[model samples]
Target: MNDTLHVVEKLTEWRARALEFEREIQKAVLGQARVIRLVTICIFARGHVLIEGDVGVGKTTLLRSASRALGGDFARVEGTVDM
Candidate 1:
């Protein structure tokens, strides 16, 4: 019971932080709600994601914004093939 209570408290705190992170990312990137939400999920899930699309679709912008929100670095690489 004590352990469960501790977990609940931590989850609540994490949820608040996650919401704030989303808000900051949104402010930095405009007109990409779905992309932002997907990035947010992948970020908290601690997994890697491959964002692909045509040029000028905001993929790089979204990832860069997310990296800034997470206080992380962003890098871009161009490849001959898509993975």
Candidate 2:
């Protein structure tokens, strides 16, 4: 049906855009293809992500790069959980 075909076409276009977005983020955050792919999937799925790692691991850079690719602003908020 024409409607089904249209849906498929839209999905293909979205997929391409998502891939391109991922590539853009990857360009800024190097040596983390797996992390980039997972973040991209979560981003396109409209989900929130909390990245945790040791200090100086480029987490902020990854997030900033993703925000840039999304044409959005990045704000860093440091959090702590006091036991």
Report how far residue 41 has shifted in candidate 2, in Å. 1.3
Instruction: Compose the digit string of candidate 2's lDDT tens values, residues 1-83.
Output: 99999999999999999899989988888899999988988998899888999999999999999999999999988787862
Give per-model TM-scores: 0.84, 0.89
lDDT (Cα, tens digit) per residue for candidate 1, span 1-83: 99999999999998898889889988878888888888888889998899989988888888888889899999988875665
For candidate 2, what is the lDDT? 0.92
Model 1: how far residue 11 lies from native, Å: 0.9
- Candidate with best TM-score: 2
Error of 2 at 56 (Å): 1.6
What's the TM for model 1?
A: 0.84
lDDT of each: 0.87, 0.92
Residue 10's lDDT in candidate 2: 98
